[model samples]
Target: MAKRDYYEVLGLGKDASADDIKKSYRKLARQYHPDVNKEADAESKFKEVKEAYDVLSDDGKRSTYDRFGHVDPNQGMGGGGGAQDFGGFGDIFDMFFGGGGGRRDPNAPQRGNDLQYTMTVEFKEAVFGKETEITIPRTETCDTCHGNGAKPGTKPESCSVCKGSGQQEVVQNTPFGRMVNRRACTNCSGTGRVIKEKCGTCHGAGKVKRQRKINIRIPAGVDDGAQIRMSGEGEGGLRGGPAGDLYIVIRVKSHEFFEREGDDIYCEVPLTFVQATLGDEIEIPTLTEKVKLKVPAGTQTGTYFRLKGKGVPKLRGYGQGDQHVKVTIVTPTNLTDEQKELLRQFGGLSSDTSNEQEHHESIFERMKKAFRGE
Candidate 1:
């Protein structure tokens, strides 16, 4: 069969730079590397890409290929050229393809798994930051053999299955020709190392389970379900990898008198009839301190008053939110004889105060406007 053009295979022009050739080869190889891309033609495409990079990467081969206009060794079978023949091209293909064998250390230490701890904070604490401690069940590096999973003074040995490569190369004879697949060695569990003298404390496992107490500073304005990550505070890694991260999932307990919406705080302030009609200055409890709220005369129920800069602070910015206080008028339930007589006299003077017909008309107008989507 005729061979494809080396330059066309890599999607590069004849004048492409060395760096350009390398970058394109890396992308194409990683994409169609066979073990990564399991398509039937992935092996052939990978081979084509490797062949292109082999010739274009070398200065002398690139000159020869340009002058002779040939990339296939079988096409121009002569070895009349002096020094640079096909001697170094195999190494170029090996580097471009990242080789067919996995050589990563299976026994190499890796980062520990990420851990999560759910903590419940009071509503006030969530609004105003607090420092607290939590106990978590996690794993840490074993004391005996120092995470090698071996007995004291004894270290793990290289795995014989993959010859300490941590990867086993399996060759498959398929219709597409011989395909090589590298996988983690089953005997070593991909660590490329095996321990014969197991640690008595951790029982061959690199980690030991225990309860740990961690102190964390919960920042203000952190809402419920917010996660705070603590670096290098998770389980210890196998062999000797870096520790993973610890995530704190916050659960803020709901306050009886206050409710939060985003950064704003909301609460209902109850007012008596005398306070609402005659007006009064009342002290309301905020997140930090109590502030005086003045109710004007004729202040109706459901009236909202905003206390600026009293709500929760912004988690990511500078300004704070406002606290919205809504008033709810309370009616007197019990009345004495003298009070009943005074109320009757007051009702006689304020006869037009109970204008039900006009209130009905206002409600009907609102309903009509709502139906019209006004």
Candidate 2:
């Protein structure tokens, strides 16, 4: 079968940018990789995508392909070339597997892996901030050999098989074409050095695991999912490289009454029905202290009041956020007989005075009118 246009195969147009071509190839490669996608034709589709990317990603190859539109590489398109001139598949594999495409010195410094610790803090503590210490187990450079993996008095020798390059090239003639790839040397296990006398403390690994104590100061107003980075606090590096960083991920526990959004705080306050009808001053709890809040006369349930500077401190800026207080009226229950009679009289008086107080509408009267459809 005639192969589809390279652009069409990757679901891209002819005018697609180099970045667009790479992104599309990566997406399709993951989608059709034989190990990941078990469909019958996935392998073929993956090869097709790979071929398109190999041609389009290189400027010289792309220009020739654009001009000639698929000339036999063996016939030499105005130049002596064949499948041997195609881009190396090692680069494609490296995109996913993190293998080095070119030669590299094994003794080069390599940074250590970063570490993350999830810290659960109390809600108030997150708002107020705290300083504490923690213990973590991590790898550190061996003190005896000083990261050389050899005894104090001895040193390592270069690998004879790979000649200290740490990698070996392999040429394979497959159905697709001739391909050259690099793999770790078997003699020295890619370290490029052989240790005759290993370090007693680290056992030739050049690193040892140990429990480390670290001090951490969590800033005020840190919310859930916030991360604090501590430099040079991660696992020890390899070959005298700098250590990686440590990240503390914060998780804030929910407060019993208060809730936070951004830097602002929200809470519900309960008010008696009588207090809602007749205004009263009540103490409300804040992050710092209790403050007096005046409930206006004839206040309704679910009414919100703002208390300035009573919420969490701004994490990045100077000022604090306001706290929103929502009042909910609570009804009285299990009244005494005398109190019940007084309530009944009060309802009657309210109905009688409805005309005098034009704004006041008795609950019973409203219900009666609703039932009568008046």
Q: Best-fitting candidate, measured by TM-score?
A: 2
Residues 1-374, candidate 1: write the lDDT tens digits.
88888899999999999999999999999999854675889989999999889879977667657765654433322345432222223233333355423233565668899898889999989988899888899999997767888899888898989888776766655444554555678999877888898999998897999999999999989999887889999999876789998988899999999999999999998888778878999999998899999999978667789999999989889989999999877666788999889977865665565776653454336435544556
**How close is each model in CA RMSD to the real structure?**
12.6, 10.6
Question: Considering only N, C-alpha and C atoms within 3 Å, which residue pairs clash in candidate 1?
Answer: 106-191, 106-192, 107-191
**Location of the lowest summed lDDT over 10 successive residues in candidate 2:** 74-83
Q: All candidates' TM-scores?
A: 0.64, 0.70
Q: Please provide the root mean square deviation of candidate 2 (C-alpha atoms, Å).
A: 10.6
Q: Which predicted model would earn the best lDDT?
A: 2
lDDT for every model? 0.80, 0.82
Kindly list the per-residue Cα lDDT of model 2 for residues 65-153, writing each as its tens digit.
68657654334112433423323444333433565534357989988888989999999999999999999889999999988899999
Q: Positional deviation of 41 in candidate 2, in angstroms?
A: 30
